[model samples]
Each structure stands twice: as structure tokens, then as C-alpha cells.
Target: MRRSRFAASVTSLLLATGLALTGAATAQASSTAATGGYVALGDSYSSGVGSGSYISSSGSCDRSTKAFPYLWNAAHSPSSFAFNACSGATTDDVLAGQLGSLNSSTALVSISIGGNDAGFADIMTTCVLSSDSSCVSKINNAKAYVDSTLPGKLDTVYNAISAKAPSARVVVLGYPRFYLLGQSCLGLSDTKRSAINSAADYIDAAIQKRALDHDFVFGDVRSPFSSHEICSGDSWLHSVNWLDIGESYHPTAAGQSGGYLPVFTANAS
Candidate 1:
């Protein structure tokens, strides 16, 4: 009986130690995964367009302290951080400009691109100012570009990223749907709003496909921004502001924190 008791005690102690060790290992690994150099790349969405409080040093690129990349770096204290994303950046722009600052030391990267490539500004301008038929035509043109040419452009950028940051975990983020469908929005009619949302979905789908093809994580923000889209009572996005035309149709700071940041945090590994 004495021997059996001693054996049982030893077994329990071993199990406890093993569980503790496993937990420690998990914590350490998570820390390690999030600790290396973080490089932010791509366009205005990543650079914080409507979020405001832009980094003065960033000039026209409009990097914001409120941006998800800046917020994540602030929270995690990565060994190094390079905010290379710019406003008005297309796939070609990223390919030419943003590929710097990525290296083997980079443990994580996040990007939001392909919107400008698909003529985001043009579509918005047409939708807001032109007839509903014109808006639909513009959206259809954008969709065609997304379906045809954007894939190759995205592939080029993704390939360059892989080459530049050979070991980094890449997270490719998608834009939020512009409007809450079935809700009463002021500017655009439901037809226009629905078409715009459909365009957003198309862009996101294209981005996701290429991200997956490159073995990168696709961070979809639509789900997070669902009830909080522009037409929602609690909207996270900015509708057209004639005062600051540049800030039109972009995520507000809340969208960055409550939407994009959380999605990135969940998928940063």
C-alpha cells in the first residue's frame, strides 16, 4: 500500500509538471512569433486615410498613429517596425516602392492593396456624382479589371514580398464593405450601394485568392465591419466628405481598432 501511494503521487507530480511546461512553451512561442521586425506595406487603408492624426514625417502617405500597423507595433513592441505603406498605392506602386524594409529578420507583414488598382477612386466618384446607371457601369468596369488584370499584378507583388521577406508570415487584409445593405443610406440609392458592395466583395475575393495562392493569411474585415458599415447607425467607415475629398470612403479610426486591428491580431501568426 505504501509503494502504491508513492507511485500515484509521482504520477500526479509528473502530469502537473508536464502541463506547466507545455503552457510555458506555448506562451514563449507566441511571444517569439510576434516579436521580430514588423513591416507594414500596401495602400491608404494600411496607411490610415480617414483615421486622421497622420504622421507628419509620412508626408502625403498619411501614416497614422491610429492605423492598425502603428497600433500593433505599439502594443507588441516588435524588435523593428517599418511603416512603408503609402496612400494611393496600387499593385505597381507597391512593387516599385514598398518592397524595401523586408528581410529575413522580418517576422510579420500586413498589407491592404488592390483597391486602387481596381479604380476605387474612380468608382466612388462616379457613384457619388453620376447617375445610378453610370455608377453601375463604373463598378462593372472595375469588376472586370479585378477579374482580369489584378490577379497578375497581385501575384507580382506577393512574389516580391516572399522574396524580400523570405521567412515572414504575411497577412493580406481586405477592405470593408462600403455600405450596410437593406439599410437606408442618404447619398447613394440602394442600387448604387449594392453595386458598390458587390465591387468590394469582388476585390476581397480576388485578394483572398492570391493571398491563399502565396500561402499567406487573408484577413477579411467584412465580417467585423458588417453591422458597422457606412449606412449602419454605428458606422465605422467614412461616407463622402466634400470638405476633405481625400478622406472620402475610407475606414475611420474605430474601423481600424475595432475591425482591422482585431482581425490582424487574430491572424498575425
Candidate 2:
């Protein structure tokens, strides 16, 4: 059975914004970072939407201390930690709204963008509530968008980031793969799960390419969450939370700590 083949003994799911972990070597941030600014940009993943403990002052942006950015800032105590990422942000949003936090004084930068640009929410909605064919079709359209358009948008963002913070070390993080195929998971079909994973791969690959092209580090979270995907025993992502739809498909606090923090830390220096 396909399930048996891919049967990872994982629990809980870390359905998250497009940021994965790759178990890279640890590099401590230089002391210069202590005096320089650290700006966190991108989307909900960067903002800590799914992890809870939302900072009341963040308003609708839903910034959370549990988010990896905040955690990093706390550990490093940079001169300034600008948390500008918002929920439902796109590349244009980052260009127009978030880049202001970045400047020559900025020393470390991290962002998790492009998923929203590729219609992640719509794709998830389709895969979750629609037929299997519909799910596949949505993924195909997203893949096409990633291939034809996302790179350019990413270039624009990366260029802007570079221009704003020429001296900063930027890290572009990826999302985790949501499911482990062949599990008797109750929600989506195996076909849909696999399709979603493929979509993540496409998105991550595209994001990684742009990051490398810009000379920024790409942080892949897949390895960190590999055994803990949806069907695993300990999931860092939240499945569909009917009560709090906003939190659906987002990483749990553990995900921010375990899956995302390490990758960002390794690349930040």
C-alpha cells in the first residue's frame, strides 16, 4: 500500500506557512548583531499567527512571542527587532509595507513570503473541501504561477530588501510538508495529501532559488518536521481548527521553536 510505503510514525501536523527546516549547521550570530538592527518580514509564518500568545499590540497582524522571529530577537537582543510581517501578506505587501523596517543598520533579516502570492489559502481550501481532482487542479495552477510569476515577484522583493539592508544577512525560510502519505488520516485523501506536499516542494524550491540568487540563505524546515508531519505522533502544526479558522494550517508554537528556529538561527549568522 502507498500508505505503508510512506507510513511515517509521526503525529500531529504542523500545517504552516511555507517554511521548512533542513538541519543546517549552527552558526552563532556575531556580536555586531547585538548592536545592529534585526528585522523580521514576510507573512503570517513570520508573524507567528498560528502559534498563539498573540501580542495584543500587534492588532490584526497577530504577532506572537512564540513566533520564531520574536524568539530569535529575545535570544540575540539586537538593537532593534522590527516585526513587520502580517497575516495574508503577498510580495506586493512586503514591498509596500514591510521593507520600511529594513535599512543599512539592519544586520539580520528573515522572511517567509511567496506562499500567499501563489494562492496558498485558496489551494488549501480547495484541497480540504473539494474533490480530489479539484485539489490536483488547484495545485497545478499554483505550480504554474510559481514557475511563471513567483520568481519575478521574489526578485523584486529581494532587490528591495538588498537595497534597504545592504549589509544584512537575510534568511528565507520554507514551509513544512503537511502530511505523511499512507496514514489513515481522516481528513484529506492520500492523493490530495501527496498533491499538497508536491505543491510545498514547488513553492520551497522556487523560494530557495530566489533566496540563493539574491545571495541570501534558504532555510528548509522539511527535515526538522519530517517524522512529525500530520500523521506523526507529535505534530507542531495545527490541523483545521473549526473553532479558530484563522489558525488553520499554521505551525504550532513547537513548530516555531523546533522546526523554524534552528534553521533561522543557523542562517542568521
Candidate 3:
């Protein structure tokens, strides 16, 4: 059986037998339902590694305490949440790993992925510092991959999620800008930033298209963050791009709060 189909069966069985139980908890935000539940899934950006403190099982990916799930949970109180947003997740992770525990009662889902597939982070690590003649080529390669691959991945993810929980409202999250367009720094350059953001725009556009195709909602976070670079005053994401070493591509605590909260709240209805 397909993984999504099997999970759906399990969910049906649980709901029928009343065997699968969720512990009741209350968040400070407004209660949206008699019982609220969510299953968050995605890559490092979803995990909050570069943004803040780690929370889930410590793999190199470093899921964070201040990730979007936390923000959403805070906004919607008295909800059950299963945050399986491991670092470095791809579309396959959502279809297989994230949906395995899903059920009909699941109210919402949010995802942020495909950065790894397009090699966005790798592009930064490789071309951001090295003044190589091939830097532009590498950026171009990342863009090409994202443009070609993201739509299919979106289809697969949306299909799998909808199959598992037909009633759940799916929200696909987009990557935030990691570079300052037309600006340069010590280790990173504006060119690389522009390239990455351009690639992100492609991915986000693909996500929005998929959302429309599948009747799911797409959250476009790029414009609201136009002037807000990573290290800028009250930025929504972390300053990983400017950092000389360590993880340099994730949201900051404030970034998640400022950028993520509005979307989560808007979509909850």
C-alpha cells in the first residue's frame, strides 16, 4: 500500500476504535476549535536550527525551540501538536516520515523545504566566500534545479498530505531572504544574495501555483521581508549569511515571530 494510504487507514482505524488519544493542552492564543491539532514537517528552516535553540532529537540538523510550530501553537491555544520537522528534510520526508502519524482529526499542517534539493545552502557555502570565476555558474545551477524540480515535489507533497488527512488545511511555507540584494559583505556578496533570493522566488512561485492547483493555501513571505535582511534591525530571520562560520542560513527568533505569526494566524481560520 502507498504510505499515505496506509497512514490514512491507520488514522481511520484510530478514529473508529477511539484508540489513538491526544493529550489536552492549552496555549495562550485564542482557541480555534474544541480540539486543535497540527503536524509540522519540513527542513532546517522549519526546524529552526539557524534561528534559535534546538528542541527535537539532536541530529546535525538542529530543530529549534523558536520555530514556526511554536509560534503557531502560541497563537492557537488548547491544541495538540506533533512537530516532526527534522533538519534537511526534502519532499520525500513529508510524504513518508511526516504523514506516518497523521490522522483525520489533524487540523492543520505547514511545511518549508526544497532549499536542500536546489542546493541553496550549498551554493552559499561554496560560492559566497570563494571569489571563483565559477561562482555565478554555481548560482545559476541552483536556480535551474529549483525551477525544474520544485513543482513536481509540491505536487507529491500536496497529494500525500491531502490523502492522509482530507480535512486538514495545508499551508506550504516559503524560504525567507538570506541575502541583502544589491549589498555586499565580508564573506558573502550581493550577487550571491540576489541569486539565492531569485531562486527562492522561483520556489515560492512554484509553491503558490501548487497550492492553487491542489486547493491548498500558499503563504508568500518574501515581499513583507523585502527591506528586512537577515541582520537588519528587528529582522525576522537570523544573520547566517553574514556570519563567517557555523550555520548561516536560518530564521532568528524575532524573524519567526514577526514573519511567521501573521501567516499562521491568517491561515488558522
Candidate 4:
């Protein structure tokens, strides 16, 4: 009877050990399956150009840890993360270089494009350094481009992304107004600031339309940055950084965290 009882004790221990091992394996498999794949593709804003503390391996892409994509991924811990956003990327540049990152396995995709295609940098330079009339003329030219040519370009890029990542939830993020309306700072008049804001609105409208037409999500950042524009006392965007021109007019870390990340996280599924 003593031997029989000892044998039963060992059998119960072995059975418990097997059950624990099986539970562990099942839990690991569930975790793996829950971790979805994510891909980020777009221009400077999406790349975190002004947020600083860039990833050295990203090179000129200027990807920052403070960028919305990285922040989102860190919080969610996706199974696979690909950051292909580059500084100065236009719609065409994305089509040529970035779309390769998207595939059927990509469960989520985020992009911020069309600003460069509108020649925003040039407009800013004109508005900042040149006369008011010069700024107006440059802005008008950009608006013309947005009206005439930008729609087709956006359509092409959106279609390509949808085709490449059929399974992915594509989110196209829009640019924010750089300055508050009728508020002047850094030598910019109300007219110039309004023009810049109008341009931003134009770009956002075009991008939003394209996103909706393609049945993708459009993340509008304008409302989120409404009170944090350049003229705001607590501005989240960087001003003209002569030392680092690339950082100029880009979002600061505060903007990335407070202004951009929340909106992205809300839309990212």
C-alpha cells in the first residue's frame, strides 16, 4: 500500500507538469497570433523630422523615436514593424520606394504625403524671407497645383497602396495649420498666416478625399493641433531652425506626443 501511494503521487506530479507545459505552449501561440504586422510610410511629418533624436540607421529619413508611428508601435507591440517613411518624400517617391514595404501580411499602414507635392517648403521660404506679395504669389501657384494636378497624383498613390496591401488598414494622415489664423509671430502677417493655413486646408481636403474614395481611413490632425500652432503660447511646432533647416516648420516632440500620437492611436486598429 505504501508503494502504491508513492506511485500515485508521482503520476499526479507528472500529469500536472504536462498540463502546465501545454498551457504555456497554447498561451505563446495565442500571443503570437494576436501580434499583428504594422507598416509606416510617408514624408517628413510621418518620419518625425522635427521631433529630434532621430534613428541613425534611418539616415536622411530622420525617423524619430518620438514619431507617432514608433510611439504607436511601442504601445501596441505589433508582431512586425516597418518604418519606411522618408524626409522630403512626395507621392511619387512613395510609389517608387515605399510601397515595397506593404504586402498582404501588413495589417496596418499609416502615411502622410502630398505636402511636398504642393511645394510647401518653397512656399514657406517665400513667405518667411520674401515680400508679402511674393508669398501670396507662391501660395497661389501651389494652390493651382493642388487644384489641377494633385488629385491625380494622390489617386495614383492611394490606388497603388490599396493594391499592394489589400489586407492592411491604410490610414492617410493630414497636415496641420502651421500658424493660428490672424495671430502674428515671427514677422508673419495675418494675411500670410491665413494663406499658409488655407494651403494646409487645401492639402488636407485633397488627401482626405482620396483616402475616402479609396475606402481608407483619413486622420485629420488640424483639430488636434488647433491650439498648439506656432503663434500659440504653448506651441508644439518648431520655428525656423537655421542651424537645422530640416527641423524647421516640423512638429516638436510635444507636438508628436500630445498633438499627433493621440489621433493616430485612436484611428489605428
Note the residue pairs that clash in candidate 3.
Answer: 27-78, 51-251, 236-255, 237-252, 238-252, 240-248
Q: What tens digits encode model 2's per-residue C-alpha lDDT throughout 96-201?
A: 8898888889998899999888988778777765799999999999999999999999999999999989999899999899987887778789999999999999
The clash count of every prediction, one per candidate, is: 0, 22, 6, 0
- TM-score to native of every candidate shown: 0.87, 0.89, 0.79, 0.85
lDDT of 1 by residue, 1-269 (tens): 01122233434433555520112212322254456899999898899888889999998788999988888887777899899999888888888888889998899999999988888877776676579999999999999999889999999999999998888999999988989888766778999999999998998999999999999999998998989988898988887544455776788888888888888877886
Better of 2 and 4 by lDDT: 2
Instruction: Tell how far residue 157 is off in model 1, in angstroms.
Output: 0.4
Task: Report the lDDT of model 2 for residue 113.
Answer: 94
Stretches of candidate 3 exceeding 4 Å from the true structure: 1-34, 56-61, 240-246
User: Taking the tens digit of each residue's C-alpha lDDT, what string does model 3 give over 1-269?
Assistant: 01122233334444565540011212234334326578787876677665657764655556666776765665564367887887667787667677775678877877777766666545654554456545677777876776787778878878888888787777777766666655444444666566666667777776678787998777766765666765355555554322312344556665665666555555655
Q: Least accurate stretch of 10 residues (summed lDDT) in model 3?
A: 20-29
How far in Å is the alpha carbon of 169 misplaced in model 2? 0.6
Q: Between candidates 1 and 4, which one is better according to TM-score?
A: 1
Question: What is the clash count of model 1?
Answer: 0
On a 0 to 100 scale, what is the lDDT of residue 138 in model 2? 93
| Comparing 1 and 2 on TM-score, the stronger one | 2
Give the distance in Å from residue 65's predicted Cα in candidate 3 to where it truly belongs.
2.3
Stretches > 4 Å off in candidate 2: 1-29
